[model samples]
Target: MFSQSVRSFTKQALQWSRIKLVHQRITLTKFTTLFFYLALFNCIILIALQTVAFVDNEDATEIITGFLNQANVTQDHIIYISNNELLKCKDLPSLSDANCETWLQEDDGDDDNDSNDSKSRRSLGGFFSARSVSVPRHHSENAKTEKYSNGTISGLELDNGKVLDTSCIQSLIWLNDVIHDSMAEDVVTLVFQIWLFFLSLATILNESLPHLGAAIAGHVLVTAWAGYRIRNTHKLREHYQELIVHQVCEGVDFLGAWWDVRTDHTIPILVFNVIAFVLATYLATRLYRVYARETFNRVRASPRLHKIYKLVLVLSVCVQLSGFFTVAATAMWLDKASTGSINRVAKHLVLYRAVFSTMAVLEIPWAILGWICIRSENRRQFWIFAGISVLLLASSSAIFASPLYQFIFQTWPFFASMTIVSYLLILVITVLGVWSRTQFGKGLPEFLKEEEKLEGADFAPVYIPDLKDRKSFDSEKGHGSDIDTEPIASLPPLLASQPLHKPPPAEKRYRTSSVYSDINRDTVKLSSTPPLAQAILSEQSPVSDCPPTPNRSNFETASRSPLSRTPGDRSERSRNSLPGNPRPINIQESSSGRPGRTGLIRI
Candidate 1:
């Protein structure tokens, strides 16, 4: 009784353990699918946030001014530029001739270059400096309002008698210049982060779940924080937009000036995010479905291909790292070595280098994972990167050699396009994963042999199909045929004497095959008809060893059913047969070709 009770307890424990294992597996599968979806969702949110964070002119202006101030542009310079009236002077040369730059020009040399420099400096100074002068008190409300209590006018009155602060116009232009510069940096930063996000997804596709999942989770968390910041930034931008619209609708005093300088940084961000969100959502849905179905299990990549993939990835990482350092060192050198155009070029070089470097660093992990997940379509992304790298390297080298490299290179547009292209490329790559072939081709690595040996017993039961039982079943169903068991009497004497080809060696046969080999063979059927012609024709020599020729009539007679042809039809056979200089004829037929087995021809 005690033994029976213990047995019952053991069986129940075994059943519970099996149930727990199945539940754990199902839970793991769900989590895997969930993480993939989360990764994609994070990317989408980040994109949206990036669009909002960087797409406000007001905020951009603030950042630019702050950056310029940090770069050592003085408060006086900012104030002068902010209120400059250079735009009112249509003819710059005339403006310079009329305005003597009393404060800015040194008047030290008589050289033409010195004179030109003086004129340019004076014109710029004049635009920012208003000709303030002491004025007598006026009774008129407007005149009184314009004059300070100290009896001084604050601004220059134009020929049209309009007082305007042109200094502010200069400030606006300066802000616009810096805004453009900072915008590039913003784009680079966002694009770099985006590159990292997709790269994490790529890793998830290729790496072991536990390791990759932890890495991806950490990355997504960082991205999520960035997204949070972006969302807040969006709110600020929206509030600013509201303020701008409110001021415009109210026809504020500076409405005309503000409208003239209005920058629509909003549209591009909106458009980019809208499109990106849609694409990301679709791709995420597909990715979710892929993981849910455990479709990645079907993908079988060769060990040699994996090695090649890793090598390519390593090469890419090396190239990216090299490019980053090269561009960075060059930019820093140029910044110290020269100014003006060179300075601008150096600034752009540094920004783009930083972007590329950040992306490269993030790409290393993904490239490592690519060994497992790299598909034919993803190959194009790498090829495109290589092409872009070559083009940029050549262009950068050429630009560096040129005297006016900065002015000629126009790095912003080019680098911006490249960043956009990178984003689009990754997006396409992510989407293509859904269509990518997942079935692993047959092959076992050397290490797998040891594993197979250890687990061989466990696998035997699955592969040990009952061939005898299958044959019996086939016979009972009347599907079994004598095609594979046919006698050699039906074959020609020459063909029958030829030995069958030996099968391939075991090692060579199993080199790239699965552990459980499923052998299959093609079945061919042969039906004999009555003899169409005699061995020798009537017209042939009696002792001739050559066989008789089969004419058109013999072919027709052969086409008929075996039952249709009579064994005693000697007259028909004689008529069909022809005197021959023929050797033995061998017939080969395939089901895919000519009907009724008319493949016979004399050699």
Candidate 2:
């Protein structure tokens, strides 16, 4: 009685433990699901904010242009100043004819008449002296302006009747170029953000480790980029403010105001970026923990296969990272090369951008395909991915060898370095992809499939047929009652005359059926048994030849031998069978419709 009570308590304890484990699993899953969606919501908000910021930056060009027009500045005036190198007029012979020293002498002579007028005149004189250029009166139509680099400039006039010098015109030109470049960068950043949003969505929905890693890496890269842009913009603002302080250009104040507005717009974006980065980091950490648990389980299940899976997973993540960098590098190159003043020998800028962008986007699909091929061991996908990788490799090489390389390098050395890094990463990814393909049929795929099955087992439903009306059900099907049914074949006379044997222990009877039925049957076929026992086994009809047992439940029928005739025993036994009685001989039918022994009947 004490043993029985102890056993009952132990069973209840085990049941409670199982329940607690299940509850923990469910709670963890719910927690992760909630946080995943929260992160996605944050991403959606970021996308909307970024889109607004992009549109605002894009419209800044028109705003700057309108401001320049209001200030009586034309595109031609800025271009003429840039092309003519008018800012260094002191070095020009034509501008040297008007003596800047005469204006300074005149301003100094009037210092006592009116101090305010003298200060303004002195400032004007000092501006000219700083550039070492003459104060120009209106240029007569007959005046010959020296040709500088590309265009010949006569003079620039502001609405205030003040002749604009090179410093003022150059500031306006710089402002226009900065706005244009900012617009281009906005476009690039917008596109990348869109890509990142979809990548994040996929990672959340698929719960894939590789996609999670890629999304995390993307967030970090974009955050760093945002910080860089903010810092650079601040520096440009300071530089323009210095120009305003020195009163170098008449329009420097307008440019400074525009910079202030641009900075205000960018501050919000940076705030959103930092918030998104934090969310991404949190989500990635949780995902990695879950991934580690699953990985640990897989390793315990199959170490060799897990090793291969680990390698493939690492390589797949690297491929994904490479693809992302490739896109980023291409975008940077496009941004720089497109905004450059220098003309490229390869005039198909649009075509080049399209081709490189397409190739960069294709890297993502290639990485996904490589992962699929490795997991599924699909040779067709393997070959397709390999072929695409090779083509991309060739295209990348051609790009390096093309004139675009020099254009990009000349435009921005940073872009050139990023491109080189992207190329090397791609090379590494391609090599790893080919290597991963070789790991096909190495049991990793099967192991993963089995793991999925085991994880899903808790949700699988069980069906138990009703057995209360079994006799009527069997009768309606034109089958005799199972209880009244006679044996289809009689035992051999020699074995029938032998004494009945005591049944095997209850524990042996309760053991679950082995999956290796064929191996058991083969063992029965080769075993040496007494002639009488063998005769009795041979005389019993095959399981398929007998009518179905309607009285027994499906679970009981599956657990016990079909030949058991008594309620007290679940398997038939022969007395004096080999020493130390083993399991009863199960006379089941083979797939070939022959009677076969599946259990050993040792004495």
Candidate 3:
């Protein structure tokens, strides 16, 4: 009767266990599928953004071509073209030998009624009309006919038979071509695409691998790519500066006319890349420590250090993003030169330059300070520091977005795009700020947390004892079996059946080396040397015919019969006459480094 009752209870327990196992399997499968779909979508978005950035190169090239057309070097817009020897057209010495066709075209009605205001507006507007016109007859013929035997046009012969040097025009054209090609090969676009691809690959890798080393490597590569981008942009900025100076030296007042020389995009690109490279470097450090299996406490000073690091990053991002808006503000302010004071424009320009220069110059030292603060014992102090810093930053933004500067967004298409990008960056930074707060460590991105979870799920195995070796102490006690004859290995079912009782206080901290106990293996050999198991055994009372006090040494020597075995094992084993196995207990330290036995089962 006792055995029959035990078997019935065990059968019901087994049925419930099977149901829970199925449910858990379904849950895990759903999670995996969700990640797979998300990764695919992420890849698509990244590829599209890269394609758009690449297409922007063509737009840049078109802007340059449009600027050159507006210069109208072939037209009688002599005011727009510099009269320097490098660029100026030569005048006819005298019309003695010149035919009517040899004389420059002139129309009395064209200049008669045009006011200075209209001329200035026309110069500011398209300066050159958008129509296909042949190059001037005098200059075009000389340019083509003066070609050397090497097929290179050395110079164009003027109407007076003197040559106008081609070197300056050729150099400017070459620089334009080089800038266009550089834009096409933008490192940001290429790096971002590659980074996203590796990130996508990480999601797939999580399905089978135990670590996200590939994704970590991608971040390191991106940091280097960002540095490369900054170098290229710096070189480009130098070229633009040189061109502006050249134009100024030749008395060309239209220095601001060329979009290539005065881009609202480059400043933003430069600032953002600097910030990103710094952040990526920090990110790589975080990932490397994890990959190397280092403890968090050893890597970082305290919980506060992480918050401080994040705060610093947030500040840098916000400051650099403001530089984008400054560019727009400068453009719009300069556009109102007819109505607004040049002093006001110059003041805003100097202020923006000062702000940008300050941030760029201090970025490295600020990062160094953040690194130093990571070792700080106090965590809450950074919050106070960060709050004050943010308030100052906000004040700076407000200054840039003041009523005086709002006209830029209203005046130029460049500022309009800058306005949109500014808003988008705001949204992005806000989301990142919120997400950073939820992280467990300093400089750890959300993606790394997800990767860690995936890795744990893939590698951490749950141990389940075999049902055949399962023994029920309650059934044995009722069946009049000899309790003394039961092995120590069979005590789990008895301990599991006992009513919940308060565990005794620890005598001392017991530290034991941990090992991976594979669930698929034939046996999990638990060492009785652990004081934790001893404490548990000491709590149990002896029954009739059982030892009054169980000897711990006896359990140490007796080989524990494995409760579970892999299905592939061919060795036959005795089956339990009655019900389910006791739940498996696990004791391992968590990531945060809390020590001692955990997850001991009651049933």
Which candidate comes out best when scored by lDDT?
Answer: 2
- Model 1, 314-388: lDDT tens digits are 433333233223333333333322432223323355555454454454444433333333333345554454444
Worst 10 residues of 2 by lDDT: 98-107
lDDT per residue as tens, model 2, 1-603: 999999999999999987775444433454345545655666677667667666666665565455444344443321212211222221111232322121111123343668745544555556434433222222222222332376644334534454545445444554565556566566656666777766665565445677777777777767777788778776555444334323454432442244455667788778888887887687578667655555455335567676777777777776766666677777776665565232222356777788788887787788778768877888998898888788778888887655555534533433554567677767876887777777777777777677666555666222221366445434332344545233323557787677677767755543323324334332222223345555455555433212332222332332433432211122333332324433443433344455434332222
Lowest-sum lDDT 10-residue window in model 1: 78-87
lDDT per residue as tens, model 3, 1-603: 999999999999999987775444323433333433443454455455445555655555554444343332232211111111122122211223212121111112344555634533443243234111122222232232355698665554445564444433333342344444444344334544444445434434333221233333333444454455556554444433333322322212112333333343444444444454454445344333323232232243356644554453454444333333333323333433222222232335656555545544443343333322323422464444344345434644675554444433332333344445544444444444444445435444433344355445646432222243213322221232333544555669888577665434454322222223324423333533344454544343322221122133322223331111112112211111112322223323233445322322112
User: What TM-score should be assigned to candidate 3?
Assistant: 0.28
Cα-based lDDT for every prediction: 0.37, 0.55, 0.38
C-alpha lDDT of residue 175 in model 2: 53
Candidate 2: regions farther than 4 A off = 1-28, 63-162, 165-175, 241-251, 295-302, 322-325, 331-340, 343-365, 397-421, 451-603
Estimated TM-score per prediction? 0.28, 0.54, 0.28
What is the model-wide C-alpha lDDT for candidate 3? 0.38
Score candidate 1 by lDDT: 0.37
RMSD in angstroms, candidate 1? 25.4
**Alpha-carbon RMSD, candidate 2:** 20.0
